[model samples]
Target: MSAPDAGGESTRDREPVLRVRGLRKAYGERLVLDDVDLDVHAGDVVCLIGSSGSGKSTLLRCLDLLEPVDDGTIHLDGVEITDPAVDERAVRRRIGMVFQAYNLFPHLTVLENCTLAPRHAHGVRRREARDRALGLLERFGLAGHADQHPDRLSGGQQQRAAVVRALCTRPELLLLDEITAALDPELVGEVLDIVRDLAAGGTTMVLATHEMSFAREVATTVCFLEGGRILEQGPPARMFSDPTHERTRSFLKRVLAP
Candidate 1:
């Protein structure tokens, strides 16, 4: 089946930016992801939402090739990335990932942190990498903190820097795993704002987020997972306001409760 574009229109002619089928992952004896299927088009912002341990983070990790799936296929731009013969490192260059924790290097300056992968992995010249890194950092309101170490910045700044670092690779797909989950309540908005901008700028993204309101506001499609399965998925307005499944409705009631 063809994927839907960011506008939710079917785009069968153009290849999907990402595709997953029968994705299953297990840790020890526990199955973390079960028979998951998903497709993301060139400009879609697909948000995966559910309670903790519902496989949101694991799914994102699988997409980024960070976690090896026990069984499934992951195709990026029509190439099956899960094949053993595929170069995992090369595949990663085209896919970016950010975790809940700000995993910036403490010793590296923010600029250095941002340029490291582009310079080392992609072989981007030092000057070119620095230029692009600074541009993204400035665009995201972190220009002033470029030379500062991550420890010097607030949680929000560090996460924003992480996003910039990911963008430096110019990845075709970005996987964001609860990027705002670690911030203080007051600081969460700043990080969400960066994601909003990325969505607006047409960056194809799949993110696992617990922020229901943010998902409703920015998601091209909302997927509600339960016990590692996608129990329901649709446009955000329908998923939030008029969910067809009782499970979805019940989950929303608790999450959106005042």
Candidate 2:
């Protein structure tokens, strides 16, 4: 993990879009992730599920190099980038992430917030960025509110805007860490509706979430993690219907229980 070449040398024929091996993270003496491994293919939606504090968010952050790893390596399409010293800006530019808290700037209009990143990150002109933002907003039915501030929009609308902001980066990988956790149950469906469309479009996505129903339907693979370790992973039907690990079965029972 210390050296740039320390990552697993075993790569597939097509090469995964994002790969992580033996990933570990610690905050002081508290271990957040322990010996984790994952891969996201070109057109796959892999959903990582676990109880709260199971290292889902930490794993996502580590993939994007937002949080430095204590041990392990990450690669994007066979390109090693999570070595001891990685290009942080370049890595972030290739990975688009949406967090639970929208994190929109209240002072800036929705249009500005969505377009600013593209303008600064890629040197896109103001007019071009504005046009791009408008196009993305219209995809989620938010074109009419482009001029409004964050506070003026509903929770669902704000979350959709955050998704558009991340899309404006034109990233190859999209990481969503429980983006609907803070919204009302009714509002949650609206935001998820947009995500559903993206999944249908065969976007490469890695989602850490509690939306079992949505994950079951849209994800090509589902992984159940417990205590920072992936207990089981397989096709959604095999995972939900025929889980082999006791922890996975228990977790599903609890999640599926009324």
Candidate 3:
């Protein structure tokens, strides 16, 4: 599939917070992402929709520098992050990622989990990290559970703590990989609510989600992927109601079937 124009005319003049071009990734002989291109401006909520194994999660991992790409150029704030000389650790400090599983340290308290990266990786003072962690926990309604371990909290609460942990770093970009995929149906809303609040507050985010209705409501831009490529992309209104590609239309029809 031909790559769609990145960000359309609305974002033409402004530099994107995240920019990707000619991105490709492969595992052995199987290519997971093929010539993918994307742009995410500051405060933009970009949703990636695709079938399993269509490379959504791998794409997120590449953006976070967790996976080394085979070929591509990825720029964060105009800096070429794909460069071999770039500091992966420093780049990671600017990008926060939350996985499907909470991935919270089992033995640590929620507050400890939230403060670890800041205190150790970012060199935040212990006291300041504690203050920032508590503040974010309070904002997300997880403050009261600060001392609890991951086992002591519900799935939703644990996920919220995970998000709060990411936010405590004040990352310029946030990547969420199927965050709701691990939650019970009844518990999904709580985690999505936190994401909604973040969107409202203008946090820059790129999320791969199966929650079609939520993506329609929350995404500034949506990209539909099939067979490891972005086949269509546009504002949610158009992408949802009228996609340019037949593959995208068919995929949406199947997923949004009533």
TM-scores of the models, in the given order? 0.95, 0.94, 0.97
* lDDT by candidate, in order shown: 0.91, 0.87, 0.93
Give lDDT tens digits, candidate 2, residues 128-198: 99999999999889999999999999999999999999999888999999999999999999989988999
Instruction: Provide the lDDT at 122 for model 2.
Output: 80
Q: What does the lDDT read for residue 157 in candidate 3?
A: 94
Between candidates 1 and 3, which one is better according to lDDT? 3
Give the clashing residue pairs of candidate 2, or none. Answer: none
Give lDDT: candidate 2, residue 54: 90
1-258 in candidate 3: lDDT tens per residue? 476844455636788999999999999999999999998999999999989999999999999999999998999999999999999999999999999998999989999999999999999999999999999999999989999998999999999999999999999999999999999999999999999999999999999999999999999999888777888888898898978888889889999997
Q: Which candidate comes out best when scored by TM-score? A: 3
The candidate 1 region of ten consecutive residues with least summed lDDT is 1-10
Regarding TM-score, does 1 or 2 come out ahead?
1
lDDT of 2 at 153: 93
Measured by lDDT, the strongest candidate is: 3
Clashing pairs in 1: none
Output the better candidate (2/3) by TM-score: 3
